[model samples]
Target: MHRMPTLSLPMYDINHQATLGLTSALTTLLQQRGVPAEVSWPQDLLPHWRDDQLLLSQTCGYPLVELLPDVQLVGTFLSSAQGCDGQRYRSWLVVRSADENLTLSDFRGRRAVCNSNDSHSGFNSLRYVIAPLAQDGKFFSATRFSGSHRQSLAALRAGEADIAAIDCITWALLRRNFPQELAGLEIIGETPLCAALPLITSAKTGAATLEKLRSALSELTSEKRYQDLLAESLISGFNVSDRAFYDEVREWKDRAAALGVTAL
Candidate 1:
């Protein structure tokens, strides 16, 4: 038997039964493809523990681009129920509770919650949308990190937060799976769509290996069962995305710095 490489996965995806399912199934798929890799869905930022054994790591909007600079981005998807292609990517500003009929102007002196400080859709993209209206400390009286997107959504549900910059992809998935959870909330507005999260690979891997992996992913939806699973997770399809696409996100970050919104 030949040895296989391991890939650490995010627990939120698995716990939510989002895209990927049980570890056994994932491992089997990898082994069948000749890349015996292990998948771990831990709850921490993957870049912190990234090692040579990691073939790929999953992360959200900005953190993925910031944290893993060397890996090759593989898959990209829109949050607002769009497919893997960036064509339909969108953003939504969600109020923490139904009673908080806060307008976009009401962001002032209120707490703002994001998935992470480095998230593009969660922070950078939102920054671009609010740049015109936000004043230094008035727009957001305070900011908090709910760690994961789910936590941020939960914070809104529990009234622990005032507003959250939610990715349209996750929001759509929640709306499909748990409509009751999002019963009273309203989308005040939408931000310009940013590039979707790309599934990435390290440069250390061989191009042939990468090609084979890409082919496998391309065909993931061809199988009926897999297609249904992805539909359940709100994934439209997998598509190829290059690193240059993320440069715009970097440029946005640079512009934010120029405006003293360096936190983005």
Candidate 2:
């Protein structure tokens, strides 16, 4: 008997309950279709994407574009959240609510936080928005890398940073699950909409397996049990996607580099 393939949905694994619920739902759906999928969480996700057993996973647009040569594009998630429109989503530039008097220009020479240098919505998108405003390829007085969107928000809330860009889907999920975390933050600006996160598979994965995975994802909305899980996960549905869809992220990177603004 052949070994079953593996799945991982780490992008939105914010908490124990949410992650487990989503994993269980996905596992059951794939298994029902005779795919024999198992949910496996890795401490570091980048390495796992290259694993031979990787059947399906999700990754941000920035990394997706960077890894296009190594990974196969499967689909993109659609969210009912405000900044999301089908496969496209944007980021909210947030600051403390008390900083209502602050404007984008005022952010100059102030501390800024970013989730990661490699993130589209969290870092690259923000750099693109600030590129025009940047002077000498510099904007913030000091920039900090928080490593994750949640940590970036935490930095702002704790007064360690003046502003940060957060993915709209993550912002929506926090609003639903932990409203208090956002009580003190306000969205002062938004970036242009780009392709949202994409579902990925190893480049070596056969087309037949990819089709089975896509079919399983499409069935989520119609299945009652999975519908509830989708609601909890803030995932409305998935749309068929291809590598070309992520070219915009590459453009963002190129534009940022052209402007000499590469991080924060």
Candidate 3:
């Protein structure tokens, strides 16, 4: 017997309760269409997508571009937030609002934090913006990984770090749901916009199965209950994404490398 197809949304699972609810609703909808689906939150989602049993998941543009030939783009999410226009999103270079004397240049030789080295909105976007300003491929006096945008914000707030690059969609959601956490933070700079995270299925997933997945996403907005879930998740809808859309991210990486600021 074939194992049930699995789906995961590890990238946007910051709000555990809400993510579970949203994915559960999607799973229910898929099952109703005779597509047996189950939700799984693996410890590390990057490797999980390579599983032949994988049916669906969302991944960052950097990984999506780097991990090509392993995963196939299925769709992209359009968030109902500022800094997001359709499937394009940007990153905000943020510092504590109280740091009145600081500017983007002032961040040089200071501590900086990012969600991960492989995150487009968290690291690559910020690197692309800072590359020209960077000297000898170096900008910050010290840099560290907080593992997620939310943590990066906290590190800045607690004085553990001087600044962070936050995904604008994550920042907007935190502003709406947890305003207290962001009360003293402000965006000091923004990176050029790039395609947002794209949904993916195993390269082995067949055309018919991919069509079923796309159909389910299109039907999400038509129902009131699912609409509510989408709002809670801060997602407006999904769109068919072109493979060329992520080329900008690859270009940014190459540009940064040329400037000698290849890693954060």
Candidate 4:
């Protein structure tokens, strides 16, 4: 069994306190199930998801297969968030209410913003949707990186950008906790649902401990005792994640690249 020094998982950081509260409860459940994992926070702005000592963490679909193939996929969180269906989720292309009459085609040559280039929800998904609409291998006149979903929303609020693709879970959490952030914003378009962020542990985790994690998470999601906690965190349940689930996500990335839609 790998020695799990800490469990660092902030699946949705917009309402980080809620995630913290839920994680604390989950850690207690893991311990009760003999995993003995303790919840901890990432030490840096960009989390080191590949850390050998990691017990469990959630990562975007893009990086899960592209960068961290060796990590053990525990399961996908079934979010109660609007764009979520079971364990799959999608990105919502959002614009201000002032632009409600405009459609995806109306945004051509418009300014675009995203959390980061590596982000599936913010970058990859948006690119995939816009690929077919791109002319001469371009769509948005300019692209901006806001560093996070909330920051991307901030850019739209301040008129720094016209459109941004935000993860639905982040949208739901912020809407529940801080409605002001999205006061004037409205979802205009969406990418197709694909594999969402799934909980992961280090590849070094042994089979026994892996089984313990699955059992604990299953109990946490299914039992009535933790219903309120799960609802507060916006997580509906959990589902088994086979790597095959991410095939289309990679295909989306490839399809965008083939259409030369990287800049969006």
> What TM-score would you give candidate 2 relative to the actual structure?
0.94
| Candidate with the larger TM-score of 1 and 3 | 3
- The digit string of per-residue lDDT tens for model 2 on 163-247 reads 9999998898888888888878999989999999888988878888889888888887656767767877778888898888889
> Which has the higher TM-score value, candidate number 1 or candidate number 4?
4
What are the lDDT scores of the predictions, listed in order? 0.64, 0.85, 0.86, 0.85
How would you encode candidate 4's per-residue C-alpha lDDT over 135-227 as one tens digit per residue?
878999999999889999999999999999999888988899999999999998888998889788888888888888888889889999888
Listed in order, each prediction's TM-score against the native is 0.84, 0.94, 0.95, 0.94
* Ten-residue stretch with the least lDDT total in model 3: 220-229
Question: Could you give candidate 1's per-residue lDDT for residues 1-264 as a string of tens digits?
Answer: 633455654522623564455334445566678876766554555642355455655555566567776666666643327422343365688884554566777676677788777777778876776665666723676778887667777777777777777777677666777676675566776776667776666657788768766676666644666765666666556667777777777777776666666652
Colliding pairs, model 2? none
Question: Each model's number of backbone clashes?
Answer: 11, 0, 0, 0
lDDT of 1: 0.64
| Distance from true location, Cα of 23 in model 3, Å | 1.1
lDDT of 1 at 111: 77
Identify the superior model by lDDT, candidate 1 or candidate 4.
Answer: 4
Candidate 2: residue 208 Cα off by (Å): 0.8
